[model samples]
Target: MKEIQAVKSSLNAVFAIKDLGQLHFSLGLEIAKTKKGIHVCQRKYALEILADAGMAGAKPVSTPMVKKNEKLFEQVVMHDVSAYRRIIGRLLYLVNTRPDISFIVKCLSQFVQAPTKQHHQAAQGILRYIKSSPAQGIFDPKDTDIQIKAFSDSDWASCILTRRSITGFCIFLGESLISWKTKKQNTVSRSSFEAEYRALAATCCEVQWVTFLLEDLDISVHHININCFKVP
Candidate 1:
């Protein structure tokens, strides 16, 4: 636990907050320590989302998106701009607890410029799915000190307008998920390799920062960088 102690020391040293000796919550993510396996969920925020989004009574969905729904997020987002933006904004926050939907959420996030009825429907569907499985969350055991490996992927020319690809990445510590993200490239690329290369550059920067953070914690990683996968 030297890594944990070192990181804690760094954080405490920088923030000047008195160390409590245990972590229950940080960065909006809740933590529960125990003798048995630990579970992490957005229990408190999930309820709030259900109530506020008018989805408490909606039926549960097995998947984030329905099958055969070929519409682009921008097309669906053109109907109700205001409501779509509001719900999507909330979903962005909810992703902290629901990484499973990270990719879908990032895709839908693009249509805030002009959300349509289809967008509202799709967003509502996601909320219903969450309502049905509010207790779903990441699980990290109380044991283990192994380095976890992950993969990042991106599909080029995915955006109809910009032809920019979508980038996805996941980070793990032993068996616990420490970070994950999927996003659209800011610039257009002529080929899949270019897109993947740009994504690699961006992810590498994150890798360096995370590695430094781990170093401060005294945790060691035999392999620090995650594998990046690409497709045209």
Candidate 2:
């Protein structure tokens, strides 16, 4: 409060600033605080993205990406690195609110540097998924518990381009997600278990850091749910 007041006072000393209590909105996020809890939404931002992507009339989807749809370069490379990067960047920001797209976005982000025609198609698949879930976001209520939990998953040799397995994980606090990632492993695994284990290690580190953050808030997060599951 001192820091805030000091800044406000300093500004007031020069420009006659008025004190406003509680922020209702800032940046691109819509801020709403209620007796039940706080609700954060980017309705305007989501609509804008949908309009920008030409998906304003897009219907909702149950799943964003599919394994069968993930294809590699049979011939032409998209050759448009700039366009790929822009789409992925927008997708990354949307991940702030859309947890479901996190895995697919992470997968498509790999080819942002030298996006082939195949990569562009893969990227389009993700945008289509986003079109389906324009209204999604992280929900934190005042009454939720602090039980931090994580589920790790791995798909061995999932990438046809680099022959790399894609690893995925999600961490939750009580019932709400705190962090998640879906990424390709740097090394090639000899077997499925090796790929799954490395993915688990990545998630373990994430959960550890998350635990420390919670501890700083005087919250004790149990580590009992740091389990790994494999998908063929």
In the range 1-232, model 1's lDDT, one tens digit per residue, is 9997898889887787676766776655676767855777777777777788777888888888774244664343353377778788988988987998887777778677876677678888888888878878888887866675666777788776777888777877777888888888888888888888877777777777777888898977776547887453
lDDT of each: 0.76, 0.76
Best by lDDT: 1
Highest-scoring model, TM-score = 2
Q: What TM-score should be assigned to candidate 2?
A: 0.80
Q: List the residue pairs that clash in candidate 2.
A: 77-117, 78-116, 78-117
- Residue 75, model 1: lDDT of 49
RMSD of each: 4.5, 3.3
Q: Provide the TM-score for each candidate, comma-separated.
A: 0.79, 0.80
